[model samples]
Target: MNWKIIFCFTLLSMLETSSSSKIYNVDPSGYVLYCPCMGRFGNQADHFLGSLAFAKALDRTLALPPWVEYRYGEPKSVQVPFTTYFKIEPLESFHKVMPMEDFMEQIAPTVWPPGNRTVFCYMPRGNPDSESCNAKEGNPFGPFWDTFDVDFNRSVFYGPLNYDVIHHNMGDAWRDKYSSEDYPVLAFTGAPASFPVQEENRRLHRYLEWSDDIDQRAEEFIRNALPKGAFIGIHLRNGPDWERACEHIDSTPSLFAAAQCLGYRNEYGRATQEMCLPSRETILQQTRKAIKDYSAKSIFVASDSDHMIDELKKEFKRMNVSVHRMPNPVPQVDLAILGRSNYFIANCISSFSAFAKRERDIKGIPSGFWAFPQKPQNIQNSSSRSDEL
Candidate 1:
């Protein structure tokens, strides 16, 4: 027997053993993947939170996609990264986060079998005539693929996906099914509305918390712009689009009683303004009440329309309360400031406002939806509004 040949055989056997052990040690949870699909920061944030909750329920890894560029006519180049806008470390212990490119190029193919990728559409559980879903189909946001310039369908699981309708009754089933799947990769599309509202909010508080930069900027703005006292944060969601939405709720004031707006569908076939958008009078009244009740010396206003901000400034000034608005406000900055407020007045239908409220809830700060008729004394007992569309 050749001694050199014997030594080579032994080395080969050891290498094979090591590889087998490593393959067995790979964690299934690490293979779980999620790609966020939606428009704007608020909608994307909702999708992120919903995906995060689903990931938590099933113990899957969430691949944070680049922010959707819904504002531009089409999905342009993604300049911002996920960690830039949100804190990823808080969720690292329980779930994993990865770049969309890595998930698409490296992880997805290995985990999911060919032609078996799953797409979970996050629409309202039971409502067939959901406007948000319709809008998503009509006006698709984000680039087709995770990595720029790649063929969307080929790069990842993109096609007529096998739709798993996620509604109130379907969460547990989906979780169990996904958890038991043999494949390593699981892909989801649409905005996040799979879990129950309360569960989603709890998870949102945990994962969607802002990054330190956002936190620092918000604090600096508050320190410099706001007076030295408790402040109220108000989300005045009024604009041409919202104004039209308000008409959906104009005839149905009863629907405004709840924190989450729900009622008959509008022309767009989704929740009407009656369910989400409050009247201007209602906004003004609520702001005044919030200021007085919370004993706030200043008010921070986040609005889509500059006209609305100016009006709030004059109105708040008349009431002898200082008004603060971000100069050329961005969504993340506005949200950060709103979260730090002593008391938060959220727009009933706006996901943007809902995001802030969730942050405040995590911090044990009080918040209320402007459209909620029955104002609660404390935030913990706040109205049960469905923030997701």
Candidate 2:
């Protein structure tokens, strides 16, 4: 053969190999896809940890779903990549994880082609006559799938069966029901995890390392903005919406993510108005005690509504305990800073607070709920040396 002909053929073969390599990277065992289409960041984060464990138990590659954000002035939900706030490297040590966007761009075409996609759920939702999964029927659900240009051709209502992979038999049940060879992709309408999160999966928070940018910003804020001495970080969930929810706190044994503080068995304490929406006086009282007990020189407040930072500053002014809050709050940075604090007191019924509380627990840092355990003296004691907080 002529040398010129040989060169053209070699180049063409190399191009073909490059295209094939992308498909080869796909896991032969299949994939686990889901939409973090629930509440805001905290709820999604809690579900994510459980879903991560679920994927490992099934021996499938977990597709890391994006963090669905609802920005002001934006009519539709914004899907931020899972890697936007966290590092995947730490997570991979636990199980195989690939960003959903990466899978959609590279592996999806080969493994899950268009017109063949199926949405999986516990059962058909909405109309009784209809057998639709209605996966993309809600706010974040529709936006989340749209982000990936994903449209399901069918729905799989794999019910009477659930996503409780805690028991060894549950995993066996799943494997027995749906084999990887037959069902290559298990795309869930929502996260395959429970709310308030399971006790076993809560420990998985260790694998969720913040992105370098978020970590650096938190460190810099602490070093430059906060006072020289140790600071107490606190989360307050007292928005208008919280006020409405707190109305039934008496009847509600556990509200929102109270399980993180109250314990799943309620061994700690049931949810209280003080824990859900503490009065300003109560907050001040708790803050003062935290400062005195921990010898904290400053306070950093994270909240959904107005954090009353000015009020805190005025009260603590005489004591010279500096008070602060993020100038432009980024939720991930707030959690990172809270996790690094000397001590943390958080809203017992807020999932947002649960994220920080869980992080502090994993690091052996003391954390407490606003007025939980009902006694001021027992606040620090109850939280001391316990990961349950």
The candidate scoring highest on TM-score is 2
Q: Which residues of candidate 2, in runs, are more than 4 Å off?
A: 1-24, 375-389
Would you list the C-alpha lDDT of every candidate in the order shown? 0.58, 0.83
Candidate 1 lDDT, 1-389, residue by residue in tens: 69899867745654554312211223466444443444456656655666666555555566666675445454454436676787666767556666554454444444653455444344422246542222213223334343433222222222232223333434455545545454355544454443224333444565666778988999899999999998988887777766664554534332222333322222112333533666678788888888889888988888887437666778888667888798878789998988888898887567677678767777888887765544233222222232223
lDDT of 2 at 102: 71
My TM-score estimates for the predictions, one after another, are 0.68, 0.90
Candidate 2's TM-score: 0.90
Model 1, runs deviating above 4 Å:
1-26, 72-79, 101-182, 191-204, 250-275, 374-389
How far off is residue 343 in model 1, in Å? Answer: 1.4
How big is the RMSD of model 2?
5.6
